[model samples]
Target: MLVDIGTEEGNSWLGHIYNLQGFVQFRLGSTEDALSFFNKAAEAFRQMRRADDGPWLVVNYGNLAWLHHHLGDQAESEAYLSKVDALMKKYPSPSQDELHAETYAEKAWTLMKFSNDRELLADYFQRAIKMQPEMVEWNTSYFLWLVNTSEHRDDGLAANILEKMRVAQEQDPENFCLAACYLEQRGKKREDVKDEARELAVKVLRNPVSSYNGMRAILRVYSNYISIDEAIALAEEALELHPDERYLKRCAALCLKRKIRYFRDRHTNQSMIDRAVSLHEEVISLYPHFSLVKNIDLANIHAKSNNGMAKADQMYQDLLKMDLKPAEKQLLYNQYEKYLNSD
Candidate 1:
């Protein structure tokens, strides 16, 4: 009915339906589809000259900005955010509590992306947090932001953030990634964090291989303090699930590299080194665009494994053939010369 009546006086009502549909799509993670509907709604607003006349336009622009940012189009996202900023300036602050909370939350997220001002960003996050304390991702992301900032790192702020995340997790049991991230950020030395990270990684692994995030958590747990056998087993499981995942392959390769060097059994360890080389080659083959970095790693791994200078030189030559940023090209050149000088 909405589509059938999309023209005439019915067009106004149809536009609202499209706007709501776009919002629903955004919430469901169909961002690209949401953007298409939002664009249609935006055109309707433009044709009706209603862009500056309603609160709906304000939220619409903000949603568009967020969607564009997720799409990796920062320039387009900023442009839409500028529109929201202008709209906010023209309107008086709403008396409604919900509107106030949403306004602060959206502004806080936007400001966090806009500037390097930790103090200011923290203030905004705090306002948003006060409005909705149970929003775990927002709180944890802000907390991580604080943890990464120079002033907050030495002040035990990450610990406080971790505590908040813990409480949030208890309230929301399904938030595995959030729990994994919080535990991962807490580092691996503490027994509590290590146990939690291991648990979360196990849960995450059982779900899907497409989750780069879950794989990262599992890798970090093994990389820091887990036993060689356990780490190797987990890596094997992950590789079986996600064969084309370069990051997971890299994680497995790194573990093998360390195990090969550190273990008491020389013959058994050499097999591990050979496996790491093979995994690195698979990653390189799958992601040729990153050949420069991949080949460098492969060359280093071969050199360490006593593969001799010939194979290493060829890997370096392959890296140099690609179009590279000046710094990347220079780094590869320096390494190549060092390899040539090696006996």
Candidate 2:
């Protein structure tokens, strides 16, 4: 459909479509296909000389650089990166930054979604938000990152973050930002936020935004406030609408795991656990970089099942050998220790 629309819309518009296709293909693990799409987009922009130095071209060049780097073609990667540098120099941003808000936000989101480097993730998000403070999505994401990366629980910090979220929500009441904010507050045991959070969850779920962030926010709300069955149902519904979204798949798998954990003794829950395992395996197969976290969850699920003890033990051993960050290593150790104690 995008290809068809792009064909009818001409080169400038086609460039954008190609860029979108490249991102989708890259997420789907078709790096070569992604490279082709990005290259075609770049060519389209170049042909339209007026747009060759536009912000869109920055995206094309940046994606090409990233794809090349991923493919281990450092020469090609650096060449494409040099193109971005040249473009930035030719068309300087009003803020005197090397990259535009769009580019920063793109990189920030990519890192937030795929990478575990919290410091880099926070820095990129801060850069993007500094430039585009009114962007509700970025604000919501930035808040989430702050909540997640805090080494210790700080009530004052949480309250400050919540106030900022309230300001953002006021600016964009219809956005998913409020849902995220309320959910975060509810998680912190703010009883006053529960009713409001539930209301926002219903509204967001009823009219879910068709974006990755939107889906994640809704899933987070359901996972916390609603029953496991409802969360799974919502995830399945969202998956039907966005069949290619691996994050939604992960959400559904996690929901199922929750159900399994909650009702492990029930015979019916066995099928749910099996299905959750299958989804986790599929996610790992699709994106091996996500394996460590997904595998940890999978190992925990297996540890609870009667027939999966050996496999769970093997997974734990393998995970312990992997080079993990201090926080990640601590989490794994704690979970494994808990499992041992449970036995």
**Top model by TM-score, which number?**
2
- Global CA lDDT computed for model 2: 0.69
- Show model 2 residue runs off by greater than 4 Å: 1-91, 94-141, 147-157, 186-189, 192-211, 236-245, 262-268, 292-296, 306-336
> How many residue pairs clash per model?
0, 0
Model 2 weakest 10-residue run by lDDT:
3-12
**In candidate 1, which residue pairs clash?**
none
lDDT of 1 at 149: 55
In candidate 1, how many Å is residue 8 off? 39
Residue range 1-343, candidate 2, lDDT tens digits = 2422324323324565677789889999999899889988778767654544666488889889999999999999999899988888876665754567657766776675568987887788788778768656667666655655652453424666777866766666655544564465556554444465556655655553333234555565566665556667877876777677665677678777777766454543566778888899988876686678788889988877768889999999999998999988998998889878765
Off by over 4 Å in 1: 1-124, 144-161, 185-189, 192-198, 210-213, 242-247, 250-254, 257-270, 285-289, 306-308, 317-323, 329-343
lDDT of each: 0.63, 0.69
Tell me how far the alpha carbon of residue 322 in candidate 2 is from the true structure, in angstroms, after superposition.
9.2
Residue 54 C-alpha lDDT in model 2: 62
